[model samples]
Target: MTTTAAAVAPKPTGSRTAALSFAGTLRSEWIKLRSLRSTVWCYGIVIAITVLFGILIAQTASATFASGGSLTQEDQQSYALLVSTLGIGFSQLVAAVLGVLVISGEYGTGMIRSTFTAVPKRLPALFAKAIVFGVVTFVVGLVSIFATALITAPMLPKSGITPDFGDSQFLLALVGGALYLALIGILSLAIGTIVRNSAGGIAASLGLVLVLPPVLQIIVAMTQAEWAQNLAMFLPDQAGGRLYAYAAEASVTGGVIVLDSLQGGLVMLAWVAVMFVIASVLLKRRDV
Candidate 1:
């Protein structure tokens, strides 16, 4: 028999992005995010926990201040912010878990292999997932914080902690708080991408976002070193929290904050950016 020319598939002719468009990746990611039951439940729980703790804090603050309980103006401001954000740390855990699950679940279930096959250039896929998830988190957090603020408004006035929603500074602080949560969500996604394991990602994320800040604080407390104590405020979570109050909080470092509220928000954003860059590089270099 005559030798026949072996058939070969045509190579992609366009740029990688043109050949494997991000629109498809973005659509697929959105679909995948919605399809997962855990996504719905975790978000639902996040919302519930946020509101539940807010109510409890409001009630507690109301009772504590009902008799015009010992309160200073400065303390009232702090307490107002605290009551409004009581569930932030708790909801952060839920958001962090969801972030880890979003990426790590694919690896855990062998879906990542299929994913990489569809889009050989992996970083776009990761970016698409992050953008979709980050936007969702930001929107949800904004709405939740707005609701919490309104719900706790009655209690705040009673506690002499009233913050005028119309006041730009107060409004900025509220917006900053929600933005902070959204950043945490994205940051956790970076952790998941880096680790490529569900539990490991979650644990690492919690450790970074929750445990490390306090541990730093403890170190400061134990050492009582001025430098060490002030350094604590520069950590991601602490720096982010600085944006949650109307006034610039005293530096843990005992130095004046040269940067304003917007700068503090930028600090948190910088942390997320660094993590994303690292995760993207690793995602590109590593095997699925």
Candidate 2:
């Protein structure tokens, strides 16, 4: 007790690590996406809905054929794409929710603070999340649509419908489906960033994806204006639908009902770009 004071231990030096690179942020986002139970359930629902609708439509088409009704090659192809993709509109909503959750859930749970702290550069977090959601949803959608098409092929004979996946139209449909879902996912991510509340994000995303198009359609009908129809076609859903057109009719003005497939893809990209810009600005300005 009288001899010497105990030597005081030196505090360990804390190492400051550099901020996470963009790739690291993307990996983190992926990890977060896959760790959530809801992600798995939502993806499963996408596949299930796609397959179920495909089978149902194929069966119905088969019955119609069995009744001796004639279906043209074009009609058969349209039906194949339509039936397999019937769930697309609904699946977009599911994707929207998933997208919203990816960002908003972090905010709701206060995990965003940790994310921001680690990344420091806020925009990368948002970008990384967008990329993660876009890629995941796109791949999932592509696989679902492809599988649905395959399943529907057997039923096609009953409908007097034969589809070749090797065909150009079928290939376009597959690619378009993937792009459409990816766009929807990105749109939802932007809204989630803007709203920050999960419910608000989901509501706004769904409203844009579903509600707005119909409202625009009604307005266009009421107006009976050429410009209105042109404008309405640019809406995200309508523009995206243009990519899968097999039998588009002429509008009242004698112009084709469909936009060029390349143009339609560009239009969809424009929507994504606009929202992405807004989201980036908001994310930069707002506190976590």
Candidate 3:
């Protein structure tokens, strides 16, 4: 009886095994992210889209110049910026979907129960997953966006679109494009956490990032209301789009709101912050 009691006895608080470090949790999440086939495919697609779009736009611009087209300096800058970041519009949808899958897949397969069981606190696992996903997504975005720029630069010189690598605005736009992608992915991850179902999460993610923008634009066009236009400017896609928009004189027309790159970035961060807080709260209070 005494031997059995001792064998089953709980260890003292100090002797209990230490909870897994955040670093360990991060490493585990990274492994899970990279091991998934969907992650591989989504990232591969992002790179491919960036390069292809760059090539297409570069060729189009070159041909136009060859046919006696002309552009002012501002137009040239805008055109170059467009070629560098146009892939962002298409790739962001993929990022949002991947973000949903990262968490929603675990929930679907019953793996989240195990993940929460291992972490016990739950929020750490959520944070770790977000951190890992955000970092990898950012790196992938950075590489693809910059690589496309370099690859397309030589194609543009014949058209008088010499890419000035030393241009601060140009560099910032490239970095901002990557940062926008990372934030978009994180925002979708938060939405997935809140929804907790793969289909619903993806639909909601894409709906916010994709559908809502166009719908709101239509409303603004039909109504021409200042409020509608201003509200549209705050949507995730609208604000994030400004991140890579060619820098120009900051001006607002007719009481409508216009966000500079920095303001746009802050608005996007606010969206992410609000969504993440909600997700963290729900993940903690709800049952896995």
Candidate 4:
């Protein structure tokens, strides 16, 4: 009798040995974002546009005044801040696209399933991505705004103008500029999470953050609605700016405003919390 050779079972091809923890997921996201070409280009553009516009506007405004025109110190300071923040509108679009890609690119490339398999708990992946995007974007915004201010300051003196960064309003505007971009970044990430489709996520984010507020402003103007105006002030963008302003003006302004800095920060935080809650629910419930 010949004995058959014993069959050997194939080694397990799939093992759960390399699961991703929250920190690991966050680190992976950071690596992915840094490795992407679009992230580099978008951030470069943001800084370039902000500085260029700040200098151009400051130079032009200074020229206009020097040509026998009049502009107050406050006006010069406010306009300088506006110039630095000019990229805010377009930068939000870049940020929204980035946010969409962070989530939707995986789906588009069929990597999302792999990601889900690695993590198993879907919400951690989403949270990790959001944290990464938010922190990176916020830091970028701060750097851009600070650099723009520094560059624009010397340029202003050439036109015989100088802004007091120590001035309450000027400081407030600077902080406001940075916070506005950060809020936009967070808002875009939320929209991206809610809408898994890249195009859909981007469109929805643009509509909600950029389009909706202006539309609401027009409506409020047409209807003369105080409530609408008040509501608009609490929007993610507005509330964030207000918080920054309040921080910058904390010592000088001192309880003069209806809503304090804490209140404004809370309002913005509430918006973020709501978006995260919705996103988490969808992430858990959806088939992704």
Return the top candidate by lDDT.
3
Taking every candidate in turn, the Cα RMSD to the unseen true structure, in Å, is: 4.6, 4.5, 3.5, 4.8
- Give the whole-model CA lDDT for all candidates, comma-separated: 0.80, 0.83, 0.91, 0.74
Error of 3 at 151 (Å): 0.6
Q: Between candidates 2 and 4, which one is better according to TM-score?
A: 2
* Clash count for each candidate, listed in order shown: 2, 0, 0, 0
What is the lDDT, from 0 to 100, of the residue 2 in candidate 1? Answer: 95
Q: Please, what are the lDDT tens digits per residue for candidate 3 over residues 1-288?
A: 355544677767986676899999999999999999999999999999998998999999987886665667667777888898899999999999999999999999999988987899998999999899999999999999999999998898789777777878888889899999999999999999999999999999999987888888899889888998899989998888888887833468989978899999999999999999999999989988
Instruction: Give the per-residue lDDT of model 1 (tens digit) for 44-133.
Output: 887787788888988887778778756665576667667677787788788888998999999999999988888888988898999999
Using TM-score as the measure, the top candidate is 3
lDDT of 2 at 193: 90
Q: If scored against the real structure, what TM-score would every candidate get?
A: 0.85, 0.90, 0.93, 0.82
Model 1 / residue 264 / CA error / Å: 2.6
Against the hidden true structure, what lDDT does model 3 obtain?
Answer: 0.91
Superposed model 1: Cα runs more than 4 Å off: 1-18, 69-78, 249-260
